[model samples]
Target: MAGTAGSGSSPLSAGGDGDDSLYPIAVLIDELRNEDVQLRLNSIKKLSTIALALGVERTRTELLPFLTDTIYDEDEVLLALAEQLGNFTGLVGGPDFAHCLLDSVRLLAVEACVSIAQLLSQDDVEVLVMPTLRQAAEDKSWRVRYMVADKFSELQKAVGPKITLNDLIPAFQNLLKDCEAEVRAAAAHKVKELCENLPSEDRETIIMNQILPYIKELVSDTNQHVKTALASVIMGLSTILGKENTIEHLLPLFLAQLKDECPEVRLNIISNLDCVNEVIGIRQLSQSLLPAIVELAEDAKWRVRLAIIEYMPLLAGQLGMEFFDEKLNSLCMAWLVDHVYAIREAATNNLMKLVQKFGTEWAQNTIVPKVLVMANDPNYLHRMTTLFCINALSEACGREITTKQMLPIVLKMAGDQVANVRFNVAKSLQKIGPLLDTDALQGEVKLVLQKLGQDEDMDVKYFAQEAISVLALA
Candidate 1:
């Protein structure tokens, strides 16, 4: 056989794409020995890939010593070298490496946690990670605290049943009070994750003991980012705590947020409560959050209302038909004719869910005729909204209404002037296709089908073909 190795070529270069084993590993390892900081940094990155790909023992013996020397290097390249080296060490040693690096990884874990948080992976979280992270949580640097939480996402998986709340809670409780808003937010999120994996019995205690007292401060956090993080943390708590606990402990805080001065904070708060009634099994939400949801339905800022609208169905479902009858009909009706096309679209989408729950008489007599008039509106988006409403209505109550009443408009829209509008029509048609008996409306329906099947836009054509198949029209 020919000689296995190439002469005078580094393994990485000679390995064909520089990845083969034949290349000289010694040459690259020597680059790490160079005094020039940039070259040393470059060698560090290449070595990290090798260490991760090769083995930790080799990396420990080789790559780790450089980190101690470069740990305080002010050059960004050297700082980066220190960071990846920590990640490599984190991966190899899991929690076990904490003793070896001592304050080196500890200091790095605290100082660069957020910026480098993403680098920590599941393998790094073994029993060793928590003790190290718990220590870093007390660092003077709040970023370390924040990064500790960001890295907590990995720990959520790695944390074993053997680990106790006592082991985890101390670190999170300490960080929750950190002066830095980002640190507090991150800490709140970690507590949320911790409760998620905890047995349900302990969830309430953890939230009460670890997460709740901080709520007022978090809600009132001057920083928008902190408020946002708290809002998410609150939602995470609800998932693990069960609906009843959510209602008693969390709902009030969420409700108060509806009136918050910051639109984003208000949006985050009320948005959580938007569909919460169903999740929590409480009719009070209909009585309480309904007004906020409806008010947000037509909010001046489109995004805020849109967030509320996305969750409207769950709220409506929780509230039930009687609730809409008593509280929501008027509000949804008012939004049906709102000036903004998106508001109208959202209003109509929610209204369609109502028709599904309530019955066709309510939709056909109360909602359909109004939507039909809007379907012919001059603004294309309004027309599209009208089409969206029709499709939703058909899915909800189309079986009850005569196809002649619904199909004429749907068929017309499948060939609308705008490509996107036509696409929506195709999607709506795809959904309703199974309910349609193609032979029933042969002439007019076939024309729409033909256009969709041959639509100039490839995406439109693809969906149209699917819609046709779903209808058995092909």
Candidate 2:
């Protein structure tokens, strides 16, 4: 186990004498037999370094057999071998050697194939790796096919154009149509990157013709997670496919995804609407996309509504004034009174985003009146929503508008019988207090805060005390 096997002058001769050369080899061979798993793994890592140091001829003759023999070892040992085996690809004699190492471990372990694919060159990939990976694509183990699918880009880059079209395309088709949903999902995820890396001519002719159909099938994949993965990369496909082709070929698939049973698929499409809008154009999106978004804004699941609320500013920014005013404004107002406290809080907090995007005049003329009505609503939650909006909007709406117009509603809310309403009033004062210019307005804010500080609810009093401290610091 410890003997050196090479015939030519050893590369180790550059560093030291015979014993020094054999010492590392002896230690690694002995450690490989060590019962401790970690010791064996560490020995494998050191073996890679030694193989590189030994150069191609010595590694092929002296190191490869010991490395290859470990393929039948326990799972942990095989994983370690898989991770380190790539380091020897350059040191091996040729593709034949790389193939033997990879082919032996691949069926037994997934990481081995992945590492070999990543480490080998374009020529070796086509000659040696392709056959093994193609076999892996049809392997009963979904995980084995998943490893092949995950390495699709690395394999394609290795083989380049000629082999990719002839060999890899068929392999990819098989992977995309694999019986395992996970394998198909993994293959679908790489389709965008694969198309992007190819020349435009090839992307259109080979990828669009061969790969795009599989991608479209994945959008309707029975597995929700698979569809979600497809949703994540759909926008990238739109860019590669170009606008007309995206609309004609891919857009129907994208639009159909909006109705996907999976909330994540729907949410992902909404989140990426800006990117989709760029390719599809805002006006074009208005017909189908906007209605779908608006429908999701009122989705039965609050999480869906929450996602739309989170994305409201981007929607407003992208849709611009006319569209925001017509569609999104009412949605924001509805969220303000949403049955869920968290949704209402988020809608209230995002008020300033609308103000920031649309300007102070828009806030003064359009938004303030609606907020004033909410402040006086019979529902204490609506009144609480108003206080939160005032707190967030004061800085954006400026000192004059806040002190004159918004401060009175906050003052009224300070005396609200609902502790939550009064607590929000106290918090709102902290933001508005600093904006008061005149002594009269400043004293009014101070009086309201002091009243709240003495209120019965401890949470309300605590917030009032915090608000007073904030104003004092200002």
Candidate 3:
């Protein structure tokens, strides 16, 4: 066999001509096992030449198994073999012989296993593919376990309902609790998908009785990534499980994640609040909503705090004006002067949405005074934030509030010491001009623009002149 394998006369080795004729299969085999990595890599690159000389049957029986054994070789050698695989189709006698190569294709082997299982007879799948996947699901490598967990829904689909309920469900249970965090995260992400794809006949029973228990464990999984992945899609289960099951089984888990230490996890849960709201109603949701609100509102990450501020109007609308004033209104005001500019800006936009939700009276009596009082704030950024709020609020507050309530602040800031603040005041005046009646636009607004247009700073003067032209007060 070694003598027959050593021949290099095969047609597939034609390009080598006389060059690699010196490197026969027997010599290459020795080199593949050679202590030197460069020599092994050279042998791996010439893999198809060796396969051609060995013929299809021997390549399947002998060559592929050898490559599989040596897969743990240097990364470069493995990469060389991988690059050679796409060209191996005819060398391995085409697609029918492709499965022989599947075991060697580790990168996408999990998906390949499920795909191949679909084409085989059910008896073969039960007897053959099931055992291989079961082994892969518990493989010592976390990567292997992750792939099994990641592709599990597709595997369940290919194997039919009975086998899935009997075999894959138990395997999925182990995967969801796999010791590796990556494996658990992968499994956690698949929880809803796997449940959704379960046979309609027994899905609810399987989820309520079998899957929900592990999901409960996963929701509190120590790894943030796992919890984040779960939170992103877990709410979809509300409709599937119905209002009763969601309230009894999942709502606590949802609220727990909303207060999770991880910002991404909290954001994901908040993003899906509508799903839970539809299932449980706003009155029931409000009971747990405030704690989640306070938790996120005070998050150390500005982006997280900014996210909660963006949700305030919707929260305020559902919780109503009285509850908002008591619970959430202070948080919104605090955000107007938040240390982060992005938070202050989002807070400005949030007020517009709230005014739109609750009307101009809410803006005037509830929010307008608090926002306007920031003109006296000692910090310039807070003072600037006051102007930004005026810009955002002017349109929503309408002619009466714009002319009487908010317009006085813009005119006062136009004489301020800071050029940036003066320039922003010019911008605010222009933004609110259309919202004002002709008298205010041509009177107090025109005087502020004329004073700012002659200011020492170029930016303040430029913006002031632009506002004059824009408001047609020139």
TM-score of each: 0.64, 0.86, 0.79
Q: In candidate 2, what are the lDDT values of residues 1-474, reduced to their tens digit?
A: 222323223334333455565667666666666667787778877866777666676677545655554434565666566667655566666545666566435454344555565556677766666676667667776766787788778767766777777877888888888888888888878878878777666678776678888888888888887888888888777777777887788778878888787999988888888877888888887776788888888998998889889999998898898888987798898899999988998898778898999999999988888988887799987887888788888899999899889888888777777999888888887777777875844577788888888988999989989988877832
- By lDDT, rank the candidates, best first: 3, 2, 1
Full-model lDDT, candidate 1: 0.62
The predicted structure with the larger TM-score, 1 or 3, is 3
Q: Look at candidate 3 and give me any clashing residue pairs.
A: none
Report clashes for each candidate as comma-separated counts.
4, 1, 0
Residues 1-474 of candidate 1 have per-residue lDDT tens digits of 111222222223334445556244556555655556676567657765666654665455434543443234433544455456455545555545543443334354432332233343434443335556666667666655566666665544445444446555666666677788788777666656666776766667776866688776677778777777777656656666667777787777776666565677766666565446446655766655566666766677877767776666665666666665676667676676667777777787788777767788877777787777776777787787777777677877765463767777787777677887887777777666666775643556556766887988887888777777776667
Query: Which scores greater on lDDT, model 1 or model 3?
Result: 3
Error in Å for residue 180 of model 1: 2.7
Model 2, position 282: C-alpha lDDT score: 82
lDDT of 3 by residue, 1-474 (tens): 011222243322344435555356767776766778787778778887788877888777767766665556544555466557645656777656656666665453566567566766677678756766777887777767887888888888888888888989999999888899999898888888888898888889999999999999988899999999999989989878888888888888988888888888888888777777788787778786667778789888999998898778778777788878888889988988888889988999998899999999888999999989999888889999998988898888888888888889889887788889999999988888888888888788898899899999999999999999998898
**Candidate 3: regions farther than 4 A off:** 1-108, 314-326, 358-365, 376-380, 417-419, 456-459
Error in Å for residue 329 of model 3: 2.8
Candidate 3 lands at a TM-score of 0.79
Q: What is the C-alpha RMSD, rounded to one decimal, of candidate 1? A: 9.9
